[model samples]
Target: MVTSFLLAAAAALLNAQEPRPVEQDGHVRPNIILINTDDMGAADWSGGGSRFIQTPHLDQMAAEGVVLTDFYASANVCTPSRAALLTGRYAVRSGLARGVIYPHSDYGLPQSEITLPSILREAGYATQIVGKWHLGTVPDAHPLEHGFDEFFGVPYSNDMSPFPLISQREVIEEEADQTQLTARYTEAAIDFIARQAGREQPFFIYLAHTFPHIPLYASDAFLGQSQAGRYGDTILEIDWSLGQLRQTLADHGVAHSTLIIFTSDNGPWFEGEAGVRGRKGDTHDGAYRVPFVAHLEGLTPPGAVSRAMAMQIDLMPTLARLAGAAMPDDRPIDGRDITALLQGGQESPHEVLVFFDNDQIAAIRTQRWRLVLRTFYRNWLVPLEQFGAVHLFDLETHGDELFNVAEDYPDVVESLSARLETLRSELEGLPQRETPLNLPGDE
Candidate 1:
């Protein structure tokens, strides 16, 4: 159970979504860094048993932090997954369901929504985001409008049109050198860290790396460095970026006081290893279950492994609580604060995790049971109940999802299906899903 203090804190968020004085919380305010990787696999790290990909820096962080084994992204794609991570609400609730937004799209997260950086910034933290801002590419929908003090990176995916690098909406490089992206993003992050080092204010850095996704590119320094080919080299470069971040923090004498979280936007793509059945863009097991690690020297126990079912949505409320920032309570928040689990709670905070492949409900996962309602094949939706059989897998016994036990666990399937129906009902009542801007060629 969550402590009374946390419960009260959560209650307080309903009134004012701003930072309160930290006297209620016992610990001093700590700097926070959220590193979100793109299309990286769950087992891509050396510590997680990567055969060819080398992620030594990530392995070292996991060795020194709590590794969350069952962490999941809210969705399987870029835009919606990022939306859930930033807003703590499902994309369906925000009307961002269906498909990814494009450069030509006029859509973005609603301005009424309060994002993670908005609360952190209100808490007297210098909030900045340095990497792919795939949520929206337009000027009005840029990170600056979404509460980030500074933004430096591409507006959309590296593969998107224009492909220009920007610094707070101003184009820095047209058609950014994709090969040197990892290194450049790292340099920008280091610069941000160095600026924040001597300041008295706590900092929140959202460093979203845009590599290991596809059309793989590597810097000259790491061009021929990995045995796993180009993908391996790209992962190594990202690892080096992590090392640089750690070194910068240490050099600035703020290593222990900073809480750094490393996770992926979703699962791996075709080239990267998923270690499970499906790859990116799918609603299957491996698609949304990405790697997650949290590091804070005295606060988080080193070398601890947590099997608690957590998600990217949880970060907003959890980080806000740690920073004494109040969350917005006007809307329904899908994320729950899992600080207790991070501190060594055995039980999971979540009763059920609903998986959204874009906007539609794809699956729901409980502690040991997973009910897959539908599957996507060749870009076509296949409703299991309509066409064939609803699939259920015992995650504990079948992590790879090799066996279907829906018939054996009829009661469990019924309960999960009922819950999924309830969730779907809520989504269905929303003011219709928004249409994304057409991709360049499609337009």
Candidate 2:
């Protein structure tokens, strides 16, 4: 009798020890890869609803991973957006709000600001960046100084090159073999993984694509490979590049251990004959809304969708959470941890996110509404302070955004407007202090 009772108790304990037969939780921390495309658009990928563009690999990424439908870049341009991606703060706080940086721009992002890789590396991640680093041109602003263990691509924008510079330390006049650059970046990244796997360290890679942003150069193989012409071909190259990265990880048997994120800096910059309308500068949904997706090998929900409000500003904190890193205490950081939403948890990162133009804050967004303060002024001479009245739109249910959203959901407009007004008034009156961030940007 005693032996039978012991056996029954052991069996009960074993059953309890087995993981509960509930849905698997994909919240485990993993290695990371972030691929950021420059000036990519909303519907550029087939999975994203682009009928003309052929993006099979991208479609697979969305299909096999969680597609974040409402993600926004922190800024509509490069420097600000990149800063937000790294620091998890809006351009306003990162001191990168005005526009993109020049090739020889004197300043870059400040070292005082703790970057995304810096945060992860502190938590034992082997961090590297293999593409555009347009954050700044100053030596102190290079990726090495900003926390990456390795840097192997253009120090500034790709347009800053045709002839690639050898190192950030010196600007040489060597011509860039665009194909070789991409291949070398991939090769170098793979080597980093091999090195880390040997040393038993995890890795983080930020691969920024330079093609499709530009002077439109393509390799012989990828050029004109699609009906969408050179532009579609360029996107195809991006897709190919994604395949290479995925294969590299899988070959190493570490694919399931890595979490890859794919997104763009901003919306497409219309420069081709496609620019017949020339409204790229209109600063509407078309100007800023871009694709954002997060993937954790064997972890993320497949073909799942998260309609949460995410932004480039949210990535740093989100990744930190995945890697179990701490937010900086020396200064306030802005990126909210939306990992819960990514895991099919949260409704949104915040009640709303503010959009900006120059030093002036411009728009606000809630769950279902977007309010653009299209305050237009040719010059600063308008002591008028704020000339742009706010526009309320039901972004979740609108098209073209040409319709007066306030005319339909008067309640949404009022609720969103009241919150926007209060936040704006308080931010406008935020007290000034003699602090590091309070200092002026190169603009």
Candidate 3:
């Protein structure tokens, strides 16, 4: 009798109209903490990008987690790139076409756009942004206005310092000292984490460190820890913050449950940091490609390195998926969820990345072949922003050179020219591209 009833039940369930949901355990979700530094490079540390600078915190995280060998940042400028990250769509789809938020422009990230915080918060995570919210500096263009539960830091760029900055909904602190501001950001994050911990809720903290950007400053402890001088000393302070954060999580017994990420917004400031081409607005590999590392106690594998094509835009969907957030269905997203690789699920992922400096220049890279349009990496964000007019190069032989990527592969150049036109037409014509801007939104 029992066997007969069981057979009937199985049959009924199989014949049900809707397929069973892919059930993800939502019991104890992981907390997320993302760290984004300004204008840093891959080799600026001991791991992948640089051999000189000592980014111990970033390096340690790489050793204990996944290191993307070829992660691209999509756009070469700060504003467009950041917009791409928040929306998970190309920046061109929004009104921002180039470098960053205008001084007093009211245009910020369109409210209708979907951001990582919106998705995660919907999934029950307490999302807060603490540091360098460069999406906009307008009255309505704030992180809280987007989706963050709290926002405390510069609404514009760090170079815009020595002026009042925003704190959540208002400009509470203006022309705040760099050291004090950073400490406050860290303190805010720690407090946010503590509050979340007390409530036993998952929290998403975006600790945007404004250190080592420019007009560099440091507290007494890190005043002179490096032979590299003030810049190096600034990095030491950054490291100190990381150590403290890690310890804070551990002290609160949430270290094993918190995911701490360390990375930069872009390559090192070219003018500020020597031996690097293109700093703030160049399209060179150095400008758009920055260091990225993700580490968590239970989920991430330690000391892993991956050469897969990763980008800042991918973080949106990845974090949302990890947080079990409901994704928006209104618009198309260019980012992919590489949770498998991050969790040691796969050694490699299949995806290509598109990079654009500005409307005048662009580049695309597949697994091996790369197409460089007429643009060098050493342009933009300067007093006189000059587009390189037109130049192409083969990325294979000229990976180190900034200006000539097509000199060797004439075939690649021709292929890229045709390919680029097709891509541009397709991306531009997409209905998801709602707010067309004067520029191609850093293409």
Candidate 4:
């Protein structure tokens, strides 16, 4: 009787450790791949209205998956947007809202915060990051310490100085070849996926591409092949990398069991078309709005288009749910689970979306209206001046944001302004850190 009871207990423990299968559709653990591009605009892809550049693979992915039309980045810049994406919280909450982190800077995403990979890793998934990190370069703040099992990429943006190629904390190359970065990163991702091909344990790959940012570079094969010049060439290379990843997944027989997401970190900086006013640094719709596409063989409907409003912050909660991972209950998560919107075209979970320019409240957007609280040109190239103190826009009628409807909708303005103030007060109550000093030419 004693031996029998001990055997029964062992079996129960093993069963509890096993992840649910896909057919059950309850807490199924599928391989997740998040592909993030740097400084890509909403209109950079052919499906998103790029006439000069051809992004056939990306267009094909959109046609065969779900396309999010009104998706937004958490912030108009890199460090803050990335922070919000990884933590499921506003960048301001982590005190990383002032500007992008420079190589010489001594700070990064706080160690106390929980990251997406950390949660997924705890749930039995092998995690890897294969491109630009940009979060932090210090030893304590490296990607390896942030829950990623492996890190093979540059520490920051390619345009930054001393851009070396690193592999698990070791600088392999003093200066990595920019031209071969996309190809090399794709190879690394394919290898990682192939290793997990038939394994019972699921995997998560964050293939963050470092191209199309600035000072763009493409391999010899694609150097002069685009009508839009070097910028277009880099985009074409990125699209090719996507096709390669898809083929590798199919080859490994894991295509049916994987979830793939493709999006940009922020808006275009100088070259790409944002399809709206302003570029990367401004608080306009163009800077925050970006292209978002998701593909899951058995889940997302083919060619489905969702105009539901969502942000980069939503990825944490949504992915955590899909991965059967528990979120950190000790802190607030600003992102909402967008699973319904992704699978069934349901209404957005968020009633109002807030846009931040660094730590300050810049604007707020509802389903049909947008209220701009403060407006100033933050782009370094553009002259600094106050465009206005407060303005309201009817996005449904005037999507261009040219007309101010504040007088027509006084009540709406009053409500949104109050909401902004409430948020400001809440942030002020949190413990603050000294804002990072912006370095010259760092955006």
Candidate 5:
């Protein structure tokens, strides 16, 4: 009787209707393609105030999709930000709270953790990842073991030494040509889409590009293509990749059934302009804030600009709700369901977000106020007036966070302090685990 009851429950759960059809062919699941760029900032695109470079494809996507003005990555660096996006939790909570996982590191994202691909695959979606997979290099922590059927990309950043491009655990190229990386990845993505279109199951693709990060490279065709120099040229190549993916979707006749997301992992590297204060490694507005555009046919209205504050952690739960996949019941999920906000809801689902600089709590921000606990990672607050123990800024009036108004807004500071304490305690109380790190003598 118990076995029969469990089977019946599973059937009932599977019958639940998703937010929308996953595929245009009347399939219960919809296709998802998330394209994430590395070290790209909020104003990197042509329409977003790029001074010299042009990103016509990205701008076109923003014009067609719901453009989010206040989108933020969960962390400043790549690994943590990626961990938060995949697990729907802070990197600290996932035991990957600090610097990136190097190739020599003995550890990676824990296998026990529930990833976005794992959840969707359980819901009968064909999962694949094509591009940077910096999460881990070990066999146990690879994308194949994590739920993706195929993984084609580098294990870490391009600047890392001996940068070989791996295809499903095998090194296909000892040293990949950085200039043609974007083009190659785009071609692979188009091929994957074409192959999946013939399958009965819906698909999920996570395309993480590794360009415009550091030691930038642009294809010969894109060289000297922009007045912004090689950096601008590199960005233009990424724009071309976007145009290719969109064309592929339309060609497959799955444009209406596919949800396309375009965003960056963090702020600009060294050369790209960070519209706000601070650059990539800092916890300032520029490091966290990024351009986000989501296109969903029959759902997201064209030319809609949303000011709702969203984060990378929120994607897991939001996509899960859209796919009718049951969220993990065993662990804590930091991400909230933003399905309503994506569908034209005005209010932001998040009221507060903690700024983490490596393993330390750098600051916390509410709707309009921010409280700085430490200025080590970012010394921008030193020039500004300081309160007794913390620095405060009213962002509504001072977007740059230059002037300190802690003396006048004591109540706001107190409220934000309280919120910060609650979050700090919550983060500290979670079971701590030793994050994996590469050693000198390791393989």
Candidate 6:
């Protein structure tokens, strides 16, 4: 049974703004499609400065839409970032801040939390997820239970064992063919859009791709087709998938009414290039910062570039506003609506963005400053003792985070540190599940 609090919240949100009627003016609610790539670096695409990987489709999106230069993933890794992205709350709030969800884990995203799909569904949109879902593996944590009407993809990362292709609730394939994952996901997404061609209901497709992560695979047509080898080939295939989606939307005459957002879950793992210092699992900009491009044929201006600071958590509130859904007032939502920034506004919706390394508060960034609260192992061969616990960097002058400005600006450190402590206390105070769900006879 659905909780009363959720029912009440949905009612309030639905009442906040009536769903716009489908009209010929093209001002109807836009179909929202989020294309999330796995373990893709900030500079993996051609538009982001990759010389080897040919991402003509992605470059076209950047050329014709708004490119967010300072966008970030909520966390440096997978599960937590995904949690924050869907919930509009920090991963810590979901009790998924510690690490990635493993196959053996029995717990998943809490049902008590409201996801973007849940809110959008209340606002009369068809919600579907067509890619990797790392949040949880159990039935209670499945995407269908979380309000997505359709679920057609893998349950977790492709690198995880016993990876199977799932269609709704059934495991269609015991072991999925990794090489065809991107193509299959794109076909599914296109099919979903085609089915909604003439329907009044606008759709929300969370098309999360499974590739470009470790154990890379590419179809025969794209293999060895890049100077950057297998990694580049995988990205090219992703680019192809994007092209297919765009063409299909245009063919169905819904291209102009669709808002397409392309980004990565986090930074690169072992391959790909990041403009900044660290890679995945680190709190540095390289790990958290990912390529962000928003394309809406009539809404977003062409050739617009924004340096505004935004994070994955912002998608919930932003999309809610776009879909005529109001945010739930019962809980604290960390993400702010970045609609203005996407449409060519200069001001960032965020004053400060927090970075987490697992459950620990690793760093925090303002527009021109970043403060490191803690440091952790970053898969570096060097001794961990070489790093410090607290450090500050003037991002405007030194974007690489090479030099420490903590000694020069003691006041900035003190202020950010205080804010971090307050956030920590707030998160710690939230009610959480007492323990992970145990299977039938587990001790």
The CA lDDT of each predicted structure is 0.82, 0.69, 0.67, 0.82, 0.79, 0.83
Give one digit per residue, the lDDT tens place, for model 6 in 38-82: 988888888988888889999999889999988999998889899
Model 3 misses residue 275 by how many Å? 9.2
Off by over 4 Å in 6: 1-27, 377-389, 428-443
Model 5: ten consecutive residues of lowest lDDT: 18-27
Model 5 residue 167 distance off true place after TM-score fit, in angstroms = 1.0
Q: Please report how far candidate 1 places residue 176 from its true position, in Å.
A: 0.7
lDDT of 3 by residue, 1-443 (tens): 22232234335445554222122362335689988877666566656644445667767777888777666666776777778878887787776655566455557887878788888887777889988877766556678877799887777676753466566667676577776766777788888877776564688998887767777888877777676677777776777687778878877767756777777777776442343344556555667777777886545668777666678888887777666787777777888887765765433343446776544336666656555543432432332123432355334445544555455556766776676676687564433222234433456
Model 1, runs deviating above 4 Å: 1-27, 271-274, 432-443
Supply the global lDDT for candidate 1. 0.82
**TM per candidate:** 0.92, 0.83, 0.82, 0.90, 0.89, 0.89
Count backbone clashes in candidate 5: 5
Deviation of model 1 at 259, angstroms = 0.6
Per-residue alpha-carbon lDDT of model 4 for 1-443, expressed as tens digits? Answer: 22232234334335453332332133456789999999888888888888888998889888888899889999998888888999999888998887787888777778998999999999889999999998887777899889999999998888789899999989999999999999999999999988987677889999889988888999999998888789889999999999999999888877766889999888988732544665787777878888898987556778988888899999999888877889999988999998766764748889889888777777889878888765554334221125434788898897768798988888998898788778778754455444356665679
lDDT of 1 by residue, 1-443 (tens): 23453455445544643332233344356688899999888888887778777788888888888888889988898888999999998878777766777778777877777899999888788888998988876566789998899998888787777799888768889899998888889998899889987777888999999988788899899987887788788889988999999999888777866789999998888833544778788868888988888887555667888887888999999998888888997889989998876765667878998898766788989989889988777878888978659999998998887788999989998898889889898865565345545554674
What is the alpha-carbon RMSD of candidate 3 to the true structure? 8.6
TM value for model 5: 0.89
Candidate 4 or 2, higher lDDT: 4
lDDT of 2 by residue, 292-331 (tens): 7766634456788887787888888777766767889777
User: Alpha-carbon error at 101 in model 4, in Å?
Assistant: 0.9
Error of 6 at 109 (Å): 0.8
Q: Whole-model lDDT for model 6 versus the true structure?
A: 0.83
Over the stretch 50-136, how does candidate 5's per-residue lDDT look in tens digits? 878899998887777788877888888899889899999998887887788786777788998999999999988888898998887
